[model samples]
Target: MKRSWWKIACVVLLVYTVVGGLLLPVPALRQLQETIRNLYFHVCMWMAMMTVFTVSVVNSIKYLRQLDLRRDIQASEYATTGVVLGLLGYATGIIWASYTWADPNNPAYASFGSIVREPKLIGTAMALLIYFAYFVLRSSITDMDKKARVSAVYNIFAYAMLFPSIWIIPRLVPSLHPGQEGNPALNVNDVDARMRLVFYPAIIGWTLLAVWITSLNVRLAFIKEKNWLNAH
Candidate 1:
């Protein structure tokens, strides 16, 4: 029970987030309106993506240091989970933007063109693409140790690129996305104190879920590679 306490908490907090995010009153901000409710899902999922990617990079560094195949497997699974979360975050963000940022006079396609051009969106796309290339790089190598070492190095590079791609360049340019001045969703000035009740918990819940999924994947990989792992 003690070992599984976080899994329980993940379920509970996600339930609370869904209910509270929909029902709770939000600050009446210009343009955002009721769509501000997406804060719990869209922003939280990005936070979860960032969290998982950080874990992935850390494990990659561990594998590089110790040359452990198990650590390499852990890193790969976590990166896979992070990519999934990033895609979810991207989906939610576009959905929210379609409703909130799209011009009423413009056709859907035209509005989508504008949304796609947004600096923040472009930056995020770049970041996701870099990670996608990481997987492709891994697949190109057939030798196990070479694959692991090369991918680990590339994973670290991908992590470093994330700052410039998603964080720095986006903030430097004018963007339709919020938090141009600082961390998105973290600005106490922009986000209502009331929303934080669900927002913070949502971040935790989503990240815990990512970690849980990665753990299962890691264990499965370990099982599949058990003979080879033992031989090494």
Candidate 2:
């Protein structure tokens, strides 16, 4: 049987994640044990979010430099995708937390309320909220040129805030999340080799998926704009 490239890629990734994760010996599987399986999805969603946000910021810069409306549109699509991925990442993280930290009934679990209040989660929410305001700002402007130009500027500022709020500030305070103050989730030495194998691919898969979704949205936007132009 034959398969499309994406189908083949998906199969390969799925098999890799499953096989590599499960094949590890019980003693070698890190402290998280089977719970580490969540890493494949949770980490991937975050990777996708970061990739989309980076693209959004780049498009914003290009728009500011060239004053092009298309770049603005591309930036919007990227930001939209990034927000979705970020939400998914947050949800996955929450679920993982519930399993690992929540449900005090289980001796192995910690309190959900405490884990939910972690700096990383709070900071991430603030970052996403800032981007959410970007959409609101874009919608409020009636003039096309003004909307694009103003949004381009705003995007630059918003992207700047994202790093500090989501990455920097979170790391500054102690939290239940993986990394310590001034450190990143990816940099922690605690992550074992088995986790790395799945975590890296999850990032790649999620990023590719975000890009694929953004490309579709861009095409749809172009088609809609062209049709509207013809109608007018």
Return the top candidate by lDDT. 1
Candidate 2 per-residue lDDT, tens place, 134-217, comes to 899999998877898888888888778767676566656667677655444477475666567676766666677788789889
Give all candidates' CA lDDT scores. Answer: 0.87, 0.75
RMSD of 1: 1.4
Off by over 4 Å in 2: 1-11, 18-31, 106-112, 182-185, 227-232
TM-score of each: 0.95, 0.82
Q: How far is candidate 2 from the true structure (C-alpha RMSD, Å)?
A: 4.0
lDDT of 1 by residue, 1-232 (tens): 9799999999999999999999988988788889999999999887888788888899999999999999989988988897898889889998898889888798888887767877767766776787789889999999999999999999998788677666567655677888876578887777789999899999999999999999999999999999979998
TM-score for predicted model 1 compared with the true structure: 0.95
Distance from true location, Cα of 9 in model 2, Å: 4.5
Indicate which candidate wins on TM-score.
Answer: 1
